[model samples]
Target: MTAAVSSAALPALLGPHCTVDPDRLRRYEIPERGEPGKASGLVVPQTEAEVASLLATCSKNGVKLVISAGRTGLVEAQRPDGEVVLSLEKLDQPLSFATPDGEVFRFGERAAPAAHADALAAWWRGIGAPPCEDAVLEVQAGMAVDAVNLLLAPLNLMWPMEMGSSSAASVGGCIANASAGANAVCYGTAAHLAIQAFGYSGDGREVLSDAPAWKAVPEDLLAINSAQPRPEWGLIGTQGVLGVITRAKIRAYAIPGQREAALIPVSDMPAAMRIHAAARALFGDDVEEFEFIGKPALELVRDLKGDAFRSPLARHDAPYYLLLQVKSHKAHIDLAGMLYEFLADAVSLPEDQIGYAPLKALKEIRHSITEASNARMRALGGGRLSFDTATPVAVFGDYLKVLEAELKAEYPDMALIAFGHAGVGGAHLHILGSKDAPVARHAKALVKIVFDVTQDFGGTFSAEHGVGTKWGDEFIARAPAEVRAALIAAKRRHDPAGTLSPRSFALDRQLAG
Candidate 1:
């Protein structure tokens, strides 16, 4: 039998950290699309003990939980549908940085390192890294990605992941989603950066990458001695179905010394691909980010930002635009000069059509595409059907062309806006329908069209945003048999009772069958 908790009994059971108040509960209800979720209560657990206790109670009673941090997820994973919301926001603090050998640097009382040169040097040496080289950070899961970078900024280091929602995306959420951003082409995804994770399994057992007893050892000697591989490796991209990540160690990199960016108008996807290839050939690893923006998406940005947002390109009528950025850590490297030289020599665009801008300005325009698309949908009194899809880089240009053609032909009234990490063959496609033909009415058909094409091109249906409840059914039905079986087996092994994120990927339904 499924267990149910009463609102009145929550406070008595979970202490002062639990709340059933509607107003407070509303904060965690907001979802990216569809109706906002409703929950019985919200629980804020500050430590691993509290999280484990709550999970134990839920496991024993068969009450469901939805793990949430930052509430910035695009997928419906965080949206609690009558289940209790277990929030890790209270655990938002840097714990300690430990090397592979177990040397720990505690950031007690202060989240960031001391500002003095001596203190900074001490931190660098403690991690056994040269000044401004690579390092690792141990932080609570609730800590925001942007906050992590802020703490590392003083040390001339960074976590290196860039998300449109970095300011609100939590460390745990990034790991759960295995998120990749525009710069993922250069730095890789969250799974690549995370070294170790500490969390509670769905059954309330302590699941840690390192030894629990290591905490009692001298701080200098706290290292991993386990003969078995870290169990947290399986939990990284599982989206909290297996466990709730409380703490993690993530790799950090020194800030690049020279960074340069350019925005160039292109005739179409093929032209954009040509320029992308040329940039990769010329700069190699120095090519940090290469992004594509459809004309409709660019127009939305220009219209929404109004007169202040002028197009960098001479003409705004181009079917596509490419935003290219290159960076180098070597202080003396002339990245801007080399980038300009490449543009002049390889790009066939007229001098007027090619435009250069600061990296920050160019990223701002790229990041604003989602906001603009949402605004357009809202204005039209219709909802949006957004997709995070990817294909092999070799056929990425052709894939987009086919997708655009199929989408326009089937749903001509729907405005198709496209943009994403072109360097990595990932794209975010949004379809906004007119009031006369609402997208909500054609949601399933639209999804089928996109997913079918994605399969044809040998691409992923859900690339970085994970398959939450929104796409769970499709994932189960359409994902390869082997992949589905593997995920199901993992889910069964880690969360047999389906106590955590029961709705995600419809694990409960799959298990029931």
Candidate 2:
């Protein structure tokens, strides 16, 4: 099929009800600042019939489709230029409270991601938490992370997925990428939290995915101190190539009766490692999040935000910062006391360097790093490449040291910024090059070095982010032939036309096969 469809013809085929203005189409064209590509025209389907009609028209006219929701993704998954772009913006509707299950929320795919948070909060006000055990919320694809949290907060419940872009990311986008942020160390990624996903396949076939993708890992097979694996959840992060996630049944956690955060300063990586080990011993199941902020990252925040950036530790000059959250369901349990005593007895954390801070305050400090890096890049007139990779927790320290050494030797002048969930092995490394350096050239080289090191350490190149076209080729090249073949077959089975996010997952070559 050739990409020859005219924008004007879209209204005739799909009807004016689904057609979008050129101004709106331009907005969807270029989503992120640095991301490549754009879109030609848009079709906003207010009803399921409209969606189906648009799909059928596109299929008949040989027009490709790219499913988009909060378009806040770093990878270019929504590049629909020269194709019929279907926007779910108008499908937003109120929560269906008359459902058979009180725990479930039937949502329209076009619901704004932020609305879920509002809905959950209102629901809690109307009726409290689930009678006995925790409950699940069925959210539509376009709901935002902040909105879900806002609604869930009053009920002493929350959808635990964390991302820097959570405020803007759609629930469907989160499920698509399986984003696991700072809290992923304890709560696991979006893949683990999503119990079921309902979506329309590329060829316009509706589908439900409730079963696990891979077998359960035996307890004996687990690494010495590694977190549990949910292989079945791997199906959640397909980058919207396989299908468009319309609705998802996700688990919500009870709000801890008690919550406290402590910022522990460490001399170096080795000392930081000790604090993580001690956290496991002292907090155990109560540990909610374990985040690390290297000196460089902290300095960036300090410089950008000025005195507004409050450091939990008095001496913000420490080599590394350990941000730990302790939570307890029992209101009577003294979490603060427990953490203090552990610090006193263990001697792993330096006595003078440890300090307590409000959870919200610490989170502000952690989130500011992203803003600082982006500000730096804007000022430097060059783009930055951030790599999210993970190695075994045991080798994470060594991996960090090696990564720093290699990056310094290769790009001596480049700024190195690091922070993320330390409990798990996931690390976020952002590097900004000189103003004169070619953005693409530096990005390519940095990606190669990082991915190579990640592979050598028996880690993954794309940790929480899905392998979009940006990383799709490298991901395919590294996969075993059998695994790659399996992926190809699955793509073909679900999207025979390969019309949705074509070239994603490296499935373009599978058409003839």
Candidate 3:
């Protein structure tokens, strides 16, 4: 049964509203686990003082705590194992703005521009919430992400975070998981977006907020970044274990007036690489996205999404089709034209043949194709596989070849889909259909094979996705001995109790005592 913290530790702090609710316990459970339940019990604290008091109580009472956000995490950060969850659900706020003397609150700590954006995102996407001018918004840890994005529409502002599960994810949840999405190539991830945050130790006795520690971040992020390490605040990837983020400020961008999307003909591998090279040179950071799907992927997109799925290659015999987009009128049309020229010159593919479908239709094509492909793969029964990895941007084509060769050698019968942001060198390599052989043996062996190749290439095992519970052993096994030790030491110094998602990594050796 799920239980709350000991009354003896700090009964005065809890009062009446703090008592654990019976139904709330079920909310924390991993519904996917069903019978083999993981997390249970949840604590809802309305204020930072309450959060601190809760943590202090939990620590004093020898209890472990896991921060719960939107619960949409794919790697299962919130996948609990009977821990008492500190649900930031109650920490909600209304829309307020940051004018010169902007609205500020002394909740856990004053929110920053970064946190304001995150709250803004969560506001638009949640419930009846809609974005208002100079909106000052705050969120509890558990608000769903889609709910937040929905609210953002009215304000003409948008959170850069765009995950597949955004409809059900939370702003705070995405940050807690340090999440990323397909659009990350252009915008980066949660870590980059988060500007300021307030963190508290399990016992609430310890508190950390970047607001006080963080010096002013510039409207020109580049200028601020040039100074390196923002003289004031510590990095945030290690924030959770270092301290729990109760509230945060995040980076946000103006909503694009209209998006331009098209499919360009990539005649061959070299031609595809050239397009990316030229595109990057011209668009620089504004290049929202550029991904190449092999002929096989396009065939799938066509077969699954039907005739609406058109590509620049009319014959469907080309080597690849690159998904292209030019976001906002602020984007340079000349750059897009240059990219078109690069593709045409590199591989004699005429620009006319590399025609584009408009942005609105392009949206349907991408969304429809991806969803359909996923459905088709799952429908075949249960053996669909996926591997996401990163390689250096220049050697991306070479990396794709290596990945294809290795996978083909292992399972000739399966279908492989090469999709993801080539700009970031991260590709989603999906394996559709199962091999005639056993999955665990083949799948595990395949992962090992790919992991070794990636490591050899000086590429990281994880680019966007952090090493969670499932990847712990693999992550430790992959890292150099010293690196692992340093990570462990850091975690201990920040969280000596192993309180923040204790199983995040296997720290039993250093933290076991």
Candidate 4:
């Protein structure tokens, strides 16, 4: 399966700086595996033409290819199994904003953390509204998510998606994984922000993009491109099955005013639900985020670290805590009392109700605790476990209880963290544990248990983080048969020779089922 593509052929395939090194491929493929040993040889192309040429060659010779972006991918999607790797790392091109007089006020730079800040430099050029009439931000696919945000944030603007691994994860990686962050409560996932992408087909012939013959198709692929295939069960349906994302047009703008936040303690799950109900009744539009965390999740954050982890409860009786956020604190009454008092008074009424509150200074306490605890968590150990699912906001009440029962049965002694946009019915449920646990079989088993329970309630198996090679075959088979069929069809349309990434979409034993 390993072929030695001649060194002279590579010069025509990539930019001046690009190379094809066996060692580099080894590095890119290592991290994604359970043991960092699954990666294969490398092919780093510096330009889109080179990328296209590489794919064309793969097609002609029947070579399997896996694309690597920022290298922060959690799954083994990019873990090449003796296949050629089409690296879009050389696509780090910079974009900018300015006057026609050549008075360049600013520019959007596309470089890794090691490079200079570019996009934010341009963000400051025009924060009110961008000029240049339909000026598209054509960021090079190799840029990392955090670098993009830092570039925009100085001007109070931000890139579309945010992942916990943003600093190390690349823009293309975010698109491939359909990354989401805390703000996904208001803004959507990467899939929503990704407007267009410049990709190549394995056939050596260009197939699609907004500008191609299939111009009728929207760049966002919102309605699904008949010419292209979508992923069956998770986001980034195109990561492996389709071609690599070399360039993308994304929505970028100013970050809202200092986003206001609060951390409040709830007596029970119902108490947390009550707060969610009253908030929806009040600032339905302004409320940007609503997150919930159980005592066990917090207890783990505290146990691994210390007392700094945010906790509203001194006593273990409450069982959970609620973290709510607003764009502005324009609520008329005392914020805490407004939500809690209403819950304790009127809102609680069976299936029509949510958890109520004893929250006196909910907002202030929540912010203070988060600010205090997050620091401790950083000092200790653990990345945000950040697993999430969403159902109809109406059915979320019923779903949460079922989700809890499922977790208790499967993940006892493990810390489970749940929070994020309850108003939208999407919740982030992460399993807090030692990094050591991430490599353990027990932890891997729980991911399935959590997904099974979440799926039975009619929730999508994945909300933001796309399924990569990390999860097992059962997870992919769990999806509906029609969906899988469509996904495979999409894969074939783009990567017909099965020479792209085999790991991105698993079509092994569960193929027929």
Candidate 5:
């Protein structure tokens, strides 16, 4: 039998919409982490007022709550254990647009000269009408990223950020994870794209909107929550433990007219770094996306994809390959020509060896690598362990060497599959461990090695992926005391009951009676 909610008053307050039936609640039990847990009940609120009321009622009734959105999180942040599962699914709504009045929202920092030129030209050809200046998109918490992009297409604007799971990722969940997409090198992360975040405090004390650099609280509270060097509004990445992110105002960018993609094979990381520098100099901000896939990863994709999958490096025996995309707002800018010219000077591959593919086709190869790896892992009856850690751009090559050396020494049989934004020094590595090995033991040992090495090099253990229930221990162990204290204080102020996603960020310690 499933555990029951602490408050019978919840059902009375939320009406028939709140469900305690086991059949309906069973589905909420398994979150993205695929953990075993039970939800006492499920609540799906439609309006911001309803959300605020639900949270207020939960606090008043002494009930725990876990916010669920898109259900795409990998860290088990939404795992519910005899708590009320608050689903944002019904909060989905059509996006609204408004011209910034200079207070509610503001235009993002002016793009560099290169990006400025690109944006202006794209704005001029605006679906037969002039683009509106200071246009901003107001998105609800539950709208999927792909749906949001579709809505913006009429204005020739897009969310700019590109993630592998955009098809199912929600705007709120992306902010909650501080997710970075493929184009993050130029477009930035969700935290940067979001200009305003509006949500109810977990304890229902306040219904507020936290915008960039806007601290509408007492100086004392700001000193506690915003004390850390990291931006405080980015608390959206805290997984709604502090509060439920109901809506966000995002800064949109114009879609580029001229876009081109190419695959280049390099002999080593040093060579890749040289190419990276050359591309930045040539394209400036026009270099929208740069992805790197080691030879091992490329081979894995090719093997799984079969005859239909062709490699861009068919003739080259290089150890690394880059999938690069260049987008320009100017119609006269020949992106393909630029790619060819850069190649002539940087790596100097023969003309016949050039593998010029369309932007969409090249992206397919990049995304397919992860898909193929997952398929292979399933076939072998073993799970894949992934690490998201980014080192300084200059020392990324050294970091890679250390990672490879440690992996080889410890687990020679495991396959090392890594692909990510090489320009930003973020590598998403998937290791396929032995099917016979114990999953718990392997995961613990491997995670320790990765975190320890990452810290030694001054790299973050959790990069784009936020630490959830799984990494709470690691976060507590590694985070500086002052930083942790600031976060806890913020949690206490926003979620006095420790009712929303309790135990996240080690906030559970404050909840002990």
Candidate 6:
């Protein structure tokens, strides 16, 4: 391999796009969780051409590049380790909207992109325009998720992939990680929403998903792609190992006209599962979100946020809580009445235990779990273990029960706080230990126990969170032999020099091994 490029030499080679400033480099190194890493330099590319040129230079020189956008990743994918940081923050612009037939709605007419959802909504209402049908938004990968929604709100549409860090999570990062949030049960994951992608391979070759004939294709890209099959939508989950995604066309959905949510106290996981089934049977596709929050997680939020964040239920004694929401785009549908009827007739939940809440309020309580858990971990001053795992919906309840039992039996002292998108059979499980009873010493063993249970329940250890450096070994060990070979081949094919995101999923180490 060629010698790695030095940070000092970057500015001379790439001009103003590259920076060796320590302060800016430090900002790109911070991850949502875990220790920060060190970067040799930071490069902020403003256009697709610049991104292509930068990748070409890095590939030729054997310089590693870690793609960073928003810097809200929890798996340390954005955390550079002596590699150059490619920040896409400056590429935050929504290009346009188009229908399948090629009708385009360019943003050039507007002075700037929509900044607030409320203002956009008011403007859209004033126009009295019908919602755009079969709409797809072509947006820069660096655009924040919330900003995308803000732009869509005016059109009575939404990207629909919701996350707690929507304000900070970028379009490309979500696509790279194939993230599925609370609304995933209805709208599905990023892979499903992203229909097209345009980017550059690690070797600096322009890559594009099959663009319709109406869309203009770069002459050079077309010439280069004459022989190779275009990358499929599955590229959404490659985690940047295959290529760097600069822009994508994401599918949009009509905003629900009527929505209602409720927090129902449950005695245990089984009860939550039963309620979830009842809701699905009652409302079908209208069940937009169903979240599970363990008692410990709920208690943590209350303790951290004080009385203002206390449980809405009259009695906060339930061992678990299920946040259920139903929505429909049809204006005539009585979503509120349906939800109340489901709770009263199907689940038989008592009035006192059923807490009817606004959709925004329910979301606040659900999203606060992560912050509250992090705060509790810091206070304890011990090792922190956070897992994003998923199981088959049929066995989700049993999976949680088995996992919880194993944790209690193996490490009784470690505090457990579990919550996540129950509608999609995914859970965010956290283990916190006090300094006096640190779990760091047995971190490996604890992880093994959890993975084993997940496997037994036909679940994935790395669900929404991609296989960053944190779970690379687990992926290598657990992936089928054919799957490993395919990934290795793709790495060699797209990133021959191992220049882009060499540290992601430890592909560099895997290649060497």
**Predicted structure with the largest TM-score when compared to the true one:** 6
By lDDT, the better pick of 1 and 6 is 6
Q: Candidate 5, TM-score vs. the true structure?
A: 0.87
- Report the lDDT tens digits of candidate 2 across residue range 12-48: 7667764557676777777564554556567776655
Model 1 ranges off by over 4 Å: 98-104, 110-130, 209-232
| Per-residue lDDT of model 1, residues 174-291, tens digit only | 8766777888777667766787778888888888653121111121221111111123466677788888999898886878888888898887787788887788778877788888
The lDDT values for all models are 0.78, 0.68, 0.57, 0.54, 0.71, 0.79
Candidate 2: clashing residue pairs, number: 9
| Candidate 5 lDDT trough over 10 residues, lowest sum | 218-227
Clash-forming residue pairs, model 2: 113-142, 113-143, 113-144, 114-144, 117-147, 117-148, 117-151, 121-151, 213-232
- What's model 2's TM-score? 0.88
Q: Choose 4 or 5, whichever is better by lDDT.
A: 5
Give the Cα-based TM-score of candidate 6 against the true structure.
Answer: 0.92
Candidate closer to the true structure by TM-score (higher is better), 3 or 6? 6
Candidate 1: C-alpha lDDT: 0.78
Tens digit of lDDT per residue, candidate 5, span 62-125? 7888778887777677778677889998766544565445322222342332333344335445
Worst 10 contiguous positions by lDDT, candidate 3: 222-231
lDDT of 2: 0.68
Which sequence of candidate numbers ranks them by TM-score, best first? 6, 1, 2, 5, 3, 4
For all candidates, what are the clash counts?
Answer: 1, 9, 33, 23, 0, 0
Q: 1-513, model 6: which lDDT tens digit per residue?
A: 124666788788766988889987777778878898888888899798999998888888778888889888777878887888889988888877665566565555223455434444554566555566578888899989998987887677889888899998999888776787888777677766787878999988988753222222121121111011123433467788888889998887888888888998887887788887788878887888888999999999889889687556877788889988888777787778877888887888778777997777778889998899989998998878988888767678888988899999989999999998877788899999899988788899999999999878777787787777888788778866777777778888888999877876678889999
Worst 10 residues of 1 by lDDT: 219-228
TM-scores, all models, native as reference: 0.90, 0.88, 0.76, 0.72, 0.87, 0.92
